[model samples]
Target: MNTPTSTHCLDWSSKPSFKPRILALAIATAFASELMAAQDSTTADKTNVQDDLVIYGGTYRNTATKTALSAEETPQGYSVIDQEELTMRNADSVATALRYSTGVNTELRGGAVTRLDLFTIRGFINYQNSYDGLQLLFNDWNLQPQIDAKALEQVEVFKGPTSTLYGSMPPGGMVNLISKKPQQDATHSIELATGSHSKKEASFDSTGQIGDSDVSYRVIGLAREQDSQADTAGDKRTLIAPSIDWQVSDKTLINFNLYYQDDPEMGIYSTLPAAGMFRDNPNGRFDQNSFSGDKNWNAYEREVTLLGYKVNHQFNDNWTLLHNARYMDATAYQENTYTSYLDTDMRTLHRRAYLTNETSETITIDNQLSGVIQTGAIEHNLLLGMDYQKLTSDIRYEDNAIAALDLFKRNNSLVDRNTLDMTDTIYSSDFTKKFEQTGVYLQDQMKIDQLVLIAGVRYDDYKGSESGKKYGVSTDTELTEEHVSGRIGALYQLDSGFAPFVSYAESYQPETGVTRNNEEFEPSTGKQWEAGVKYSAQDGRLSGSLVAYQITKDNVPTRDPNGSPYDLIQAGEVESKGIELELNAQISNNLMLSAFYSRQDVEVTKDNNGLQGKTPVWTPEQTLSIWANYDIYTGTLAGTTLGYGIRHIGKAQMDAMNTDTVPSATLMDLSVGYDLAGLSTAASGASVRLSVNNLFDKESYSCYDSNNCWFGAERTVEASLKYDF
Candidate 1:
């Protein structure tokens, strides 16, 4: 592990020198008088998997890089969860799809009750998820809206800071979900599924040319309803999305997309006391699926809608332009009885009732210009882009204390809402807030024979304002901030199919409080230095990477270790050093495997909160995961297949103090299915698969604090039947 000082001194902002010769050539090519002259070599060379599907390791356009590069050709370390992987695992959520991917820990906080995609990348939690490379937003800002897994073509995860391409994000990493687009080839599919907890689901997808007039369209929809592992907990959801692509002219193309979702049965995710989960409790331990809240008064519902559009234009073979715009709205309403306290005896827990409503609206726009040119002895791939986002939210709430409950004598009966003390319920707050951010970036990838160099820079301006009534008093607050971030990397290709790479990156995120000197605190900043080796096979059967990095974050906001909540400081620092190994291989004629391992040491070097050297909760030091699937090619079971997967998470301390520990556990999963390849024409492409998760029914717990502890998943079984045309 490199010292923290090394990361900050790497001078990641350094830029490479390029020539105006290529710029002059690019301009000449763009202004060529030939209107319909043949297409250039650079036209439509977009690294899109949808354009050319990949069954094994293949090409990809990392939105993070803004340039299409093969896995081994890129300097940054990343992971890709493709469609084949999604199908083999029968994953239905974004978190589940990336469960085996490295640098990710999807604990599924609150489990089936809340159904929020809760996870951490590296050692930090960030909400910078993107849909088709654009930020995803919800009208209801309190909860994350889970995207239907089927709607995604792939999920790309880039580890470490990426503020150079994007803007204002956590230092750990980000997840970018690529949405399925309209396909030129005609295709249609339908699937039906049933599983434990009376789970029932149906999905339909269709894509093809409307009339062969240079236009394509696609539509996808699904409906799902399922009970939970816990008593009286379940959820129902419906989703529909449609998209269209049109080549209006030889030089211009446009695409549009729309998505909507509704949830009628959202429940409060369940939680328990850390004492009852990690250590011996004065009272008896509660069962893993115990329901500790009022069942009747817990009412929750949410809805989301999104619309987006993209335009691409080619001025000539060497120059291209792209513009994308999106709008999203989300709303949520809830009235619930929630757990509020665990008494000194650890046997008594308090409850509370609340009614809340929230709504959020967001609009984003992104534009980029790309050009290909050659200067002297080097070829340059250049990209210049700009993005702007505006978000607004409204929140309202009222709450009151509710009756207490004793764990020893459990009550399964629902609590009547009318019985609560309504007098104690008063308006907590009603407010509206608006935020806006704009960013501009420039990047270039230049190649000189076996050596590839990448450099990029970005600038961002952010502003926010809040206004509303609090306790019948008008309140208002406004903030403005700006930041500059950058990155540089170099890669060398070897004759032995090995590539060595080194890179440095930086990022910044705004803080919310003022320093002790009465001036606003400076934004938190992060810097990282990484080196690694990448591998790819000429036969396209294997691809993998081994990467090591040291990252440090400064100006972290800390509560006055000895003062009140209003008293805060920002002179804190933390560092993380780790190595990650991942690989995907088509090992044999009938077998495939994917594996990953990660080891990291994250610590707070300086802090005012008395956690100077403590490791935060939920971040394990080591993790290992493997998944393998095999097909039968001979005998009567020729069309049958089997798959297995396992993941092990090391011990995680319950809190920063390390007083309690969450024991390590290994989880297992199994899947079996039969392909109808030799069946009659009508059923030729039909298939059925059965999946059993948590094969051993192992039990475990996870927590980030003493107040919020989560129980791991239990046994689950599901079967799916699908027909294709």
Candidate 2:
């Protein structure tokens, strides 16, 4: 076992010379702009400032980028879900809010039992989720928390490999959650909601300036408890987040935030036998709400605390500096029993119970300097950034055999969850994993009148170590890796609000697997080439993008079933080619529309065991979603609004071997809202809305293979009442 030695630790600590050089370069670059600013006394800036609605209603412009290029000018595939859209859909989790995103798929691992949000972007699974442009870590092996979307101003999905700006990520893409910031004008809202499955929820949010002291505060809190559609399963959550902004001086500002979460006691559901679901069955399909696992016996509890801060300073009108950091501590314990596999008879199911405990801590910091300058006839938007991320985790996994159940005679009360004891559980494995990554990136978005050129490059250093007792044997290993990634693109704008662009991006993802020859597998690399056209109405009421792209990943790791366990092969390659179209428009004073269409073909281009040319699991060939809302403008129904949404998912294969395929599914959602003030003067600031999901009660399922499957959501009706003061 090659454990990370003390010498390696020394090597990790020996890379600080780059920092001072970067700082010095940033300073020199900012000074280089002095003559340009002095030369051009009058330059009409077509850019948005800090306080502007960088993300105004359905606007493609975003402040999250460290540069001045909006979505249209960035020359990459992107999607944004504003607060108004999420609120209208009544989205509760990050996954729910992003289901309509092009080429995206979300999964709930253990069904209603473990309602954590997991996702696959494009054709690859990703674990990198960002909050307020910073990393958010909530992982316990396969278990992760479902981020609350209620406190977010918007969610941005960057398609393709984004490692040039964001550090070490899955080849697919990333999700960026933008937190709601403190506002200058007073804003406050209180809401109460209830829905099917005996759900009850309440939330409060308020933001405004503080007593004219050049300070502002925003606080958001929510509590919810609900019964799961799965039998005997229930989940509860409580969260509080308080943030503050202090304008220390005219050119500098400080921001701080604290978040606390107490989420415990959620069930984790896996699945039933394929005999009843996919293949010929001795018995019929199990009851949709039947209890396969004892909800009380299975416990998934978690708690998390996060502290973060940011500082921004403007040295001059052309340059600004920003520093942001965050630290998180998360702990969780889980014990659950799931069907191990199907029995020979196919009518009875066997079970296995597992117990695990996890504790993880992470720290991330990013420092950036962004500026705008001009040289002759060219305008440059430049950003330089350095980031560091570190994480350490400890986990314990154990297993035990559990009694089986007769599929034909299933009832919640049949299993006495209270009598189950963990005392007899056998310890199986314990391990600790630690990871560190540091990156320095720079991007320049240059504009020459109607033409914009975007380019970026990044260098990354990574090290990972794992130590544990496996199979009653002690083992430890370490891997050190480094790589460079970049993106380049150009966008040409026409006089009629149309933009045509072409872009290329690449990524490097390190792996821990070693080959039979004891040689570590090389990092997987991803490359993409894309071309698109964008349109933005001058009034900012309409935006759209039509993009065509091709992406390929190489050096993917795989195991040959016909070979030894240690025979790991790195000769795997996969490719995804797709087209995406997105549109958001406010056609008239009362009508709003949002729609998207994505068609993808993901296949293994190179592999062993006849796996070549096969479709991987969870890659849907087509996905389409559309939503429209219209508000009554006058007369008797002046205060009323109606909304309708439709979603379609194309067929998908179950595994790399293509043994089975899950059929496509479609769903519909409806919403209605009315302002109470129009009905009576006493309720001036009160309003009510009702939303129904899966309006037709469709039976949809997501399958990973023949043995593993997930049932989709059932019909649900929820109503919310809100008051603004």
Candidate 3:
């Protein structure tokens, strides 16, 4: 066995202006002679489309060919949102970036300082988050995009009951964030942006070699402050992240990452009843004082560290082995207020602080052997591998109280006293919890003629423990479960540009709560089957895909009459079927367009609460997104670009009864930018961009659960500047 050394970084910065200038002059000199032909706009359109640049699949390579081929590919639906799309959309936070993604929902709470966003994928809610393939240990809401969009290479969304590979989670997808690694060569850039809602932000990123021996490092930092269109609410955030990569030897590489973030509590702006009814009030005003008392004082502080090591060795040209291992630790604290119709006039002050510690390490050893067996008639690529992962998490919580008046009218100018009421009204619970999980997987890939096939299977074991007080009584419980999951699929390419594929996969999620009768429920299992067709141009410039999928989950836990509020064991069975279509093409060198459309039917097939026919609360039936950008110049004026986009979300039911619902809504945005050369004191290239959001000033709701609801932002405008050297 031998290890592989670090490879040089990839670069994409190149510009040639002379050729465009010469072509421009020639066209201008022949303008009169070609006037008659030019008069026909159709002729110009044909010429322009031929000159456009097509980005078939953006910058990331599709190397998961083996994983994507299977009769049952572990039956899960996953999607990758790349850096190019994130940058083009100017997403400021993780929640905003995933807004239009299929089967994903976001919930925003509190003011800027105490803002909490949650994502539910395919009827599953995820409170635990991960970064760089490692779990981020925090229970309270944490904003991720604050870390700097420029620092992330891509965000992978793995959907439909994925606890077999992970340890514990809601019945949703997992979002794996991939961070930018240190580049072999030096590169630097700076960005300054000002946008609607009085928002201002500045960020910088740089990478280069650290020392003489093949050691490289990268650092990214960002600071942002914005006032909300709503009164008395906004957010301010600061983040710093740095990473280093060292090539210890030909077959060994080590990487380290450190990150820190600070955010203060801001006021919470929420909708209020027109006069007395919660759901009946449609055009209700935002109760700026909804969280007035001590609850209004919310804030979050977080820190995380990650260390990783990778080793690869080529036993020979026909066989190889690869291994990767990582460790991570993180923590966070938050406080807010809650109010109910029972005490509508008085806010019930509640304080919550959660601390989590997690560590995970994975090792995979794979051998790939290939040879031509029957001359040009038979070829094989065989793969054999073993995979292992161990993860543990410890969580603690604290609850406190403040006077109703103090919670409804909090003053951020000063810190309020920590008054302890010790009375029956004051409630507090302390808990220390731990969870462990392990998984081993094996996979194989084979090719014959023009057909490709892939297969894989994994076995997972999970255990959890909770030790704390329940209703003033000491409580301790332990739970365990195991599952075997796998996937298989095949792909066939036709002579033209068409390729059809089919796959089947199985997934599992660990159960977190017991049944009303005190019996621990087994892990929930999900099975998925899918088929799709893809088309692409010969040059790989234009491509499109149409896919249909169905998923079913069984063995869900039911609610307990005496269960805690946080206990979310499944109540019954759920089934979902959906279709998605995506298209990407470069109409011309100066113009490009991308679009996606999805429709899903999610229902609870079996439940204890008579909720079988109800629609999932946050699962929108339809979602659509489109974006197009055009460059105004080809050479010296090439920096000018104009862009516009729109997102539409279909109506969604809010409650199990399905009587109350949030209607479908559409939002539009526009942007324009110009690049200036040799005008910056610190760099040679500078650009300024202006954007308008919700151009129609639509007043609509973005999300609503039974107990809480959020309104989308109104009309807002912002401008930004960037300098590169």
TM-scores, all models, native as reference: 0.89, 0.89, 0.78
Cα distance off (Å), candidate 1, residue 352: 2.3
Q: Score candidate 1 by lDDT.
A: 0.71
| 131 Cα displacement, candidate 2 (Å) | 0.5
Model 1, 1-725: lDDT tens digits are 00111111111010111122243234334433232243233424322222221221111236657656555667887888888778888888887787798878785353555445657778766644788767774222354566879898888898888888878677888888887878777999999999988999999999988885667788999999988666676778899999887655655556788999998776555466777666779776767677666676666688888888776666656766666778778787776654566798787877666666777777776676777789999988888888777777776766677667776676745466667654423436577766677788999988999998999999987766556753344546566888899999999998777899999999877664344344566677999999999988888798889999998999765434354222456647878889999988999989999899988888889876677887766678888999998999888777788999998988887765677778888999999988877454466889899998888988877875565677777778999999888
lDDT of 3: 0.52
What CA RMSD would you report for each candidate?
Answer: 7.2, 6.3, 15.2
- Residues 1-725 of candidate 2 have per-residue lDDT tens digits of 10001000001110111122344345434543432232322223312224322342111124335654567777888888888789888788887787677868775332353455667788777655888777765332633534578778889898888888877766788888888887657899999999998989999999988886666789999999888777777788999999887665555556788888888756545465545755677677765565566654567788888898776656667776666778788888876666666678776677766667888777777777788889988998888888777777776766666678777776434345565554434346577767777788998889999999989999988777667753244547677888999999999999889999999999777665455455666678999999999999899899999999999998766544454422446657989999999998998999999899999898889975677888877778899999999999799887888989998978788544787777788999999999998889899889999999889987666765565666777788999999999
lDDT of each: 0.71, 0.72, 0.52
Q: How many clashes in each structure?
A: 3, 5, 42
* lDDT string, candidate 3, 78-116, tens digits: 566788667666666666667546566654331222344
Which prediction has more favorable lDDT, 1 or 3? 1
Q: Report the C-alpha displacement of residue 529, candidate 2, in angstroms.
A: 0.5
lDDT of 3 at 541: 68
Predictions ranked by TM-score, top down? 2, 1, 3
The TM-score, computed over Cα atoms with residue i paired to residue i, of candidate 1 is 0.89
